[model samples]
Target: MLLLLPTLIGLVVAASIPPSIPHETLEVIPDGWKLHSTAEDSQTIALQISILHHHTDYLDIAHDVSNPESANYGNYLGAEELEASLPEYQRSAAEVVSWLNNHAISKTTLDGDWLHFETTVGQAKELLGADFMYYQHGSDDPVLRTRKYDIPIHLRDAIDFIYPTTHFMRPKWPAKMHLLPRQHIPTGPVTCATSICPKNLTAKYNITHVPADSNSGSQLGIGGFLEQYPDHKVVQQFLKDYGLRHHDKPYKYKVTLINGGKDPNIPAKSGAEALLDVEYGMAIADSLPVTYFSTGGRPARTPSQPGNKVVPRNESGNEPWIAFLQHILKMKSPPQVLSLSYTDDELDVPLPYARKVCSLCAQLAARGVSVIVASGDGGSAGTTTKDCKGPNGKLRFIPTFPASCPWVTTVGATNDYGVAHYSSGGFSNYFARPKWQDKAVSGYRTLLNGSHMAWYNKTGRAYPDVALAGSGYLTAGGGATYQQKGTSASTPVFAAMVALLNDKRLRAGKPVLGFLNPLLYKNEGMFRDVTEGDTDGCEVGSEVEVGFGASKGWDAASGLGEPDFAKLLKVLT
Candidate 1:
């Protein structure tokens, strides 16, 4: 009876503790999305459950392989090699599968670390102890989701997060640029005074070397999101009008569609953002092979009407960036340099989701792929707006995501004068500063001397890792010429520059510059430092010039100045 009494007490204690814990929760639904009626019990929902993955030191490995001084420099991991390095997940998978089976959900597909399943709303609600509801973003069809969910306490260690939950990140409309008819086409060398052309950029940066045919394997990728599709005819017209030498007569580029994405050549439906991206990238890189990744999901649907027919109806449930990454990461040989000219505010994305995406970027870096992203166009404010106050109603500076992610290279905007006043640059409220950029950012912090201290997080990650000419650029599309400006223009142009450098490295038998931040920080002399201009737009009520300004070295306004192609080529080789 004494031994039995101890056993009985142990059983009672175990039964008293709650079986589940909160996994992902939000106090309220994110803005730009409205809650509709509760989802029907019979309505089906597809969920991607992310099992918590073992953290690998991909950052350390990326830095080691990218540093020029290191003996292991350029020794990047292949697909199988990287797979072998990851921790085995048999135990984690078994536990999650067991929990799902307990809820009568036996049909599930496991892809890498993600478990995919389709279940009715009633069953899903009972499984996760959540209330499912319909959420409509503008005029788009409603989506099924829950404000919060809980998982069994025993399975907490095995699962990282799940989605179709609290994450509401969707594609917004691209930046608006006023289109103007062309007055005249340049028959000779383009001048830098009127507007920026491929010729002007090549001359300004001293980019004389064209990619050789032998280095065609070195490709550049331009990420296209929402419904933006580039037209080949526009690109051809741009090359001819600008009088820039190109590899192909028709100006060809490969199209890779992901998640039911489309690549149509319809002139009327051509997108300005897509045209701007491909026009400059193809012109600058010249003969280098370029691939346009048209990723579907997060359609550009407004309250008035649906976006163009560039995406599938079923794709509305997925996130564009996630869909893009899922496709790109599977390839054995992706492009050496990939550029994305899209950005969202850091606070708008959930912390867990952001970390997960950033880790994938780190993996790409380890595989010798350089990812470049635009640093937004909101100056020191937020994404495409000039508000000084933050989401919490506090007067603070806002930073953009992916730019603040630390793994990818973030590019800011500059003009013929100096740094563009609307070039977005600030410290992140989410990620801490990486050690690689400590010296460069510290110099700027010292120059700042504690000014605007309360407006930002001092210990957070700082960005606009590099800068480029952003304004007064000419782009052609849909049989019309237009003038465009923003960090989006600068991103593709800089990516094209990197693509050329990749070609040189391949010809020289050296590896492509995988993660460029480590190398760029070490050799500040490769860039032409801009000691003038300020990122000014954060004026609230009576405050004037209430944002970050450029300094002698690295500043938030123009990061390490614009790239000098000749100097970069010499140092890189």
Candidate 2:
């Protein structure tokens, strides 16, 4: 049983500070956008102020807890302990709250490093020292944002950034498409079918067995965004179809609804993405308990009103991912392994927001959770046309986040044990490469030998860390079975494998593999290195094309390659 930490009382201090100074301009309003003078200043807007933390302290804790060589390995921190270790936030929070109180905005809530408060546009502009305006994107509704903002010099140390201020992070859906004419599901049991199935894939990868008793303590979490709901009925059918369910047994799993998350019963509206995630995870790790987290809030825009304008469906709370992270952090114990299939181009999200989300992943790692994210299905360049365009107006290879985040393990897609053409891979423009992957990435760079090198950031973090079968899988959704494909399929498959590994470790009286990169990089030989195929996409007419090819070692197309589960288990044990 995990022990919960008592909340510590924060001390509020009042200080006389100088007037605000001209701070850095975070984002510039796009060209040809005119401000709406009639836009309501009284419109209520909820803001999430992200506070800075002691970077070294958290990084040290993450390393010490994850590295097997360290004496502190497996000694994970509780939520309270993590909070206490970063004392910078406490002082910073008090100062910011005091400042807020003085501005007649005394009603504010603080959760870890996030300070939440509701303020009008007029008051927000006054507090942040900026002008708020409406900017139109395509035919979408005018989004309210500030071109630039200033924070008081004294309070700068306390706050890193604010969300919904200048950042626009759109959530991406799983990459699933119907099989081509040549592709078809086999007539026999899914396990014996030629197409990739849980049973066949597991057997081939040497992950055929998991201890039954270990299921009681092991849990796997699947994150759902954009209102995708995982129905229980569809999951049961999927399990039965794959021979994973007992004849008379009913489907069983936990459902956590965060911020109005829903599990729609209707087949037409029941999300195929959610169904694929839950079914694959439960089918792969049959014994382990699965928790489907249906997180709420509109991660993307929806068509609304007159003239087909696009607008956010939920504007009441933080972004879906942020809210989901906060909810998990507040728990006494979060799932050891979490699989997220949603992602967006790294360039679409502002630097500060990306860093904040990545920092939260680091925090999750310190507490023993292994975050597995899809590397995306946009090939070498990201899915967006505008986002892929470089500063020089040339099409460049773009990466996705939080796959590009160094803390989380990213899984790419493969078809029949080879790299899939649409599997997204590349280096990040915002984040630098972490020390753990330096040698492998450096080797890849040497292999490239300056070929297409100018299209990406050489020092940026490279992905993905692993690959798995991502195409020609049968999935049940909307009351019917269909073939699906994408790195979305690979992520859950890899996560379930990790969950099984954790179960084995626990049964053997060992700690779960927390923050997989350290162990993964150290034991690269444990995996089946994929050396063929390439990711192809991001075409800009006849002049430019973007993609990366598989190589002998770790390459952008397929990381260290598919996991050889039996080998991985033997090595870890």
Question: Quick one: best lDDT, which candidate?
Answer: 1
Instruction: Give the TM-scores of the predictions, in the order they appear.
Output: 0.90, 0.89
TM-score of 2: 0.89
RMSD of each: 4.7, 8.3
564, model 2: CA deviation in Å? 1.3
Give one digit per residue, the lDDT tens place, for model 1 in 234-296: 677777777467445566888999977898888777898998898899888887788999987
lDDT for model 2, on a 0 to 1 scale? Answer: 0.77
Q: lDDT score, residue 228, model 1?
A: 92
Tens-digit per-residue lDDT, 142-239, candidate 2: 55567677788788777888777676555777567674344233333643464666777777788756444434466799998887877776667667
Q: Which runs in model 2 stand beyond 4 Å of their true positions? A: 1-18, 22-38, 136-142, 179-194, 214-216, 245-248, 299-317, 391-395
Number of the top TM-score candidate: 1
